[model samples]
Target: MEQKDQLLQKVWLWSLLFFLVAAFTGFVYRWGLIGGDILGLRMSNVRHAHSHLMFFNWVTPVPLVFMARHLMKTAPEAYSSLKWCITVIILIGFASYPFFLIYGYHPVQIGTANLPFSVMLSGLVMIGWYWFGLIYLKYRNKADSSLSQLFYDGALVMLVVSSLGAWGVAVAQFGNIDNNLISGALTHFFLTTFTEGWCVLAAIGIFYDLSKKNYSLPVDKNWLIAPIVLGAPLMFPFGLSVDLLNESLLWTAKFGSLLVGIGLGINLWYMARALPSRNKVIWLFVLAMLALKVTIQLSAVFLPETLWLGQHGLRVLYLHLMLLGFVSTLFFAAFHTVNTRSSKAGVYLFLGSVFVLIATLVLISGLWPPAWQPTNVYRWVTVGAILPSIAIAVELVVAGYSRFKQG
Candidate 1:
């Protein structure tokens, strides 16, 4: 049992390494696209690959593994199946994503739905999470009552819900619904639910667990759960109706964002009190970046023109803000606090975050006109991007080596 546990730990850690490599490659390719060309790689292919690997392979695996570890501890009898389920999800993600990158969005038809290789893998993951849900439902009574646990439960549910976006595309093929708005909205639905719902919930749960373990900040599972849980899923309707402009959905989006803002503000307040012992600067930056992420998400309701940005190139900037600025930073904090291992990579993480932010800012600034910017701003943005890539690359190596050394 002990050996198997250690092996599982290694698999999860190695997944992080793979995520770093894939993310670095993706960002570099993105910069290359901006800078006219890098090695003549196909931009679409790289973008497809980058998003798949980052979304499927890297982001969820980390939190899933951590959450599974906790579940197994509380319900030892279910350990064997839980372990296998997670391993299978990881393997399927690792195997399937490269094909998507190479094949573009090729989702084959089967009955009422298209079954792309990527979507198939996602289906398998959804199965894994179903078992996860079962574990929770069957054994939750054995666990203590806490908000963290509720958040974790919500995270698992959201993870399962998030996969439907891919399946919806498959379903659309059969339904003969091929309009770009509806299709794009569905895709956005998945990304938003996964990021704002599953990822955010897991981060909160893990953050709470870390703080409780430290026994310093008396973390409470307060009424804030109301807002967070209520808000996260409500705005998902926004994605389905993004272009249609329904009055009900528009108002729902506004209300949902308000609830989310309140939930997030509460979390931020508690987190700020706990910040001194955290990798203070990095965590605070994460909070700020998270605020920015929420603001961007809600911008469509506030400034209707914002809805158009997703189809525009601005979508890339939005994704980078969430993936790099918010999700990744909080992920590191979760690992740091949960494992109680002090790492020297905070500086790298912080600097890399700043570089990525600056690159986004510069790129979005529209290069501001030829005379005022003189030098090609896209080229400069690419240059700034190199810092984060290098810093993150180093941070990956440091994290992997340290974990390996400990094992």
Candidate 2:
């Protein structure tokens, strides 16, 4: 039990560290202290590190840790080995990412050049998925706790699908494939599977776990399950060709985004209504996340028409706002809740992070205007970036200390 607690503690520490590195890189880059074109190899290298650290190091570990709590109670062997494997892989992956950044290699290039390391990392992730799936299936068969069991089952399925999609993308990149269709399909499969599938499912699981502890809102298993049901088939044709569905695909993506927005909005609204009147921090955080979602959908609407928005910069801004503002903030809030027991300090940390993130998003998005001068825009972005790093660091320290003391 003590070992399990320590493992989770380490995961939290790594999450915080990687998050800080990403935040710092964004701050420096925006400030012009890092001299390079945003689309150049140098910037791509940094962005690669930023994305992997955020997704694998920070995001992936959260649900694994959350699931660990339940697995420790039932499938201790799987939980223990999974933790050890994940820890080693995370350390190795983090260490190698900096080298890739320094050498200005694309992630695919890095993965191929360091095949052994990549294979080892992939094996570790596979072990995590296997163990997590085994535990989830075992618990579901046993049928003990209905709430968490359902959440875990959903998460496990999403994780498996997402992992398969990732593998397909990797194969397409590394394998000598002459077909553009195969390559394009793999890329789309990877993107939507991770962003829309795994991320959303894990988030729903986290929300279920957190909200059930604090509020009496009803959980609709159907709402949690609906995306996978619709997404699986819709993603099939969508991945084959964007032009296949043509205008219909555009409408489908738009409508899908709307449905997602509405579903998430309902969850947040329920949470807001259920919270005590004194919990202003959660309220504000919820509002910020909802705003972030709206921005994401709007960005999607603008994405296919890149000629109007200078495809590269606007797309970058869209991704940053969605990943950094929406997803990261929600994860931070959940991390705070779990680590700090919903302490006032935790609340303050969350609120502070959201405030800074909102400011950063506005500045970056506004910089998209054609008439906007680069110098002034970059200055504002730099200033905006610094605030969020400070806020996140403070939050992590406080939460880490709190968790340590409790343990």
Candidate 3:
């Protein structure tokens, strides 16, 4: 049983590695080293590959694997089938990344073929998440009353909703064959729903669960349910009405963001009070989370059209801060904390990665001008990339060693 758990953990870790690599490639492309034309299909292909790999293969799967192992501890009979479902989901998600890369390069011709692969992959993920959600719900109902149980239940629902939103995107791509408007609507729906609803909420749930493992605190019932209760009404209308994507939709997303941010703030404050005064790593993680929440608020207000930053650059920077700086860093910290033999090393790795990530975003968003000065921008980005890669590599090695020693 321990061996099986270790194997699953490795799979989850490798998925994170893949996500980091994909994210780095995206940063490189954004900096204009790899792709020649910013507007060309090749750039689009790379972006597509980056998005799927980061979200599906990297972010979503890691939490799924962690939750699955937890489930196996109590409900061993369900383990085999859940593991199989995860394997299928990962394989399909992996296969789709290359297809996205190809489609990006040959947008007009290869996209047709690529769309089917994406559809199939999205379908598989939805099914896998459904199974996982059912398992979580079953476990939550049976488990002892705890904050972790609440988080598990909440994350499962977010996962299912996110998967369904992804499927909506796949369907919208099909809509593109006839009308670009419908396709655009679906794409927007997918982005907002997945990012705000599933990705962010699930990350919070994981953080909540990890916090409970370390200290006892009352779960904020409002924060736990705010994303779904608010996000659903905000996102559901997007599928049915194309007009919601215009300007009015911003209010809903902003409101949801405010609620989530307040909730996170309360939780983090509680966590800080609970932690020992010497834990700088946890403090850094909390600050990163606050930064992310602030970034989300900025994006909600200025995205697709900020005065100084422009729409394109602001969107990219917003995503970078939230995903790498906020979500990924917290996850790295939590993982290191749980597996404490290398906790110090893990904190170093996480902090180093975050510093590089922030530097990269600042250069990309603050330095670049519309007139095209690529020399200094590329150099700084290249330098920024090195820190995080080395940090994450050290983290992976140390984590592997710690796990092995335990075995």
Q: Model 3: per-residue lDDT, tens digit, 1-407? A: 36446646677567766766776657656555633454454666677788878877777777776676666667666667777777776777787777677664233345444335555665776776777676666765444555555655665665565565566656555555566555555565666566656666666665655553456446655564565546433543223333334556545655655555555566566655544334456656656665565655545545543343234554566666767767777667656545555546755666766676676666566435646655666666656765676676666777667667776
Worst 10 residues of 2 by lDDT: 233-242
lDDT value for model 2: 0.59
Most accurate candidate by lDDT: 1
Candidate 3: regions farther than 4 A off: 1-8, 31-41, 105-115, 176-181, 212-220, 227-229, 232-245, 275-283, 295-310, 343-347, 366-375, 404-407
lDDT (C-alpha) at residue 211 in model 1: 58
Q: What is the C-alpha lDDT of each candidate?
A: 0.66, 0.59, 0.61
Best by TM-score: 1
- The predicted structure with the larger lDDT, 1 or 3, is 1
Better of 2 and 3 by TM-score: 3
What TM-score fits each model? 0.82, 0.76, 0.80
Tens digits of lDDT, candidate 2, 63-127: 67766655665555665566765675467556655654554333345544654344445545556
Candidate 2 stretches with Cα past 4 Å from truth are: 1-7, 31-41, 73-79, 103-127, 140-148, 178-182, 213-220, 232-249, 274-280, 294-314, 341-350, 366-375, 403-407
